[model samples]
Target: MKRTTIIALMMLFGISFSKAQTSPTAEDKIHSFVSIKNPPTFPGGMAAFYKFLGENIKYPEQAKKENIQGTVFVSFVIEKDGSVSNVKTVRGLGAGTDQEAERVLGLSPNWVAGTLDGKPVRVKYNIPIKFANKTAK
Candidate 1:
């Protein structure tokens, strides 16, 4: 009986150990691109991307009224699944331009995820959003 109980316990322990080894945790799944072979891309290209931005960005009324014009810098992570996340302003222009920049970026479609050694990985990208007030001098 003692020997049988010991064997059963050993089997249970072995199974649990095997399960732990096979299952990866969230920490192990982080696939950020510190060094990458290729950069991420939009669906069409850079020109199309800029065009999309131009078409989508609506000049904030407050900004237009105040004649605020400058560049807003934004940073975000393009995940391995081609989804954008962690969007933030690295540098911001006031008069509602900063919030507008964040809004426009949040509306952006997923980009082609970056590649590290041919494997898809999350990459951090920074971009400057230009705010030009055509009506203002």
Candidate 2:
């Protein structure tokens, strides 16, 4: 009977230990740009990010034809592993800029992960994309 009780207690402790190991803390939480020690960055930095945008951003023909010119604001999460996800346009000009902006962000390469207290953490980031007809309109 004593041996059975000892085994049961051991199992309970083991289960609780496993649960403790999996429990999340502030370190696991997604942090805002201003809150983290190091904000996430494109691999080469903001200049590189803009260069990538200029190279990859495609102006929708509909937008060009309509002379739609404005900025789209996109928001996304940089995960702990530096992957971009949950991309969305927070504000946008019509004529497909919203969807285009989201698509461009989806094509983004992984970023340098943000860190808090010297450990990697997820971060929320935002960017604004400007569009112009640029065709003598």
Candidate 3:
């Protein structure tokens, strides 16, 4: 009786421990940017990040011709595995600029995942992309 009781308690304790220490999952809650200890980063930091945006984002011909310029705020989740997902434009200037911004952002390579309490976590990130024609005044 004593041995059976001890084994049952140990098994119960082990199961609870495993459940509590589980890592974040794809459907797991996303941590806000402000709460992250180490925020996610592009492969080469801000400069490289901007360079990538510049190289990928193309100004719409119509927008360029009409001189429609503004900043597009893109938001997404950087997953614990460094994959980009849920890309969206929070604020956009319409007229193809919105679609272009989303497209370029979706093309981005994986980033360094953010961390909280020293463990990798999914983080919500936002970036403002400026759309300015060379001739914009």
Total backbone collisions for each predicted model: 0, 0, 0
Q: Please tell me which model should have the higher lDDT, number 2 or number 3.
A: 3
Error (Å) of candidate 1 at residue 115 is 1.1
lDDT scores in order? 0.84, 0.88, 0.88
Q: Name the runs in model 3 displaced over 4 angstroms.
A: 1-27
Q: lDDT, candidate 2, residue 118?
A: 85
Q: What lDDT tens digits, residue by residue, belong to model 1 across residues 1-137? A: 99999999999999999999999764235443455668788889878878888999999999999988999998878878888788899999889998888888788898987776677777787889999999896
Q: What ordering of candidates by lDDT runs from best to worst? A: 3, 2, 1
| Best model number under lDDT | 3
lDDT of 3 by residue, 1-137 (tens): 99999999999999999988896555587988887669998999989989999999889988987889889998989988998899999998987898998898889899999988778888898889999888777
Off by over 4 Å in 2: 1-28
Which pairs clash (backbone N, Cα, C closer than 3 Å) in model 2?
none
Give TM per candidate.
0.74, 0.78, 0.76
- Best prediction by TM-score: 2
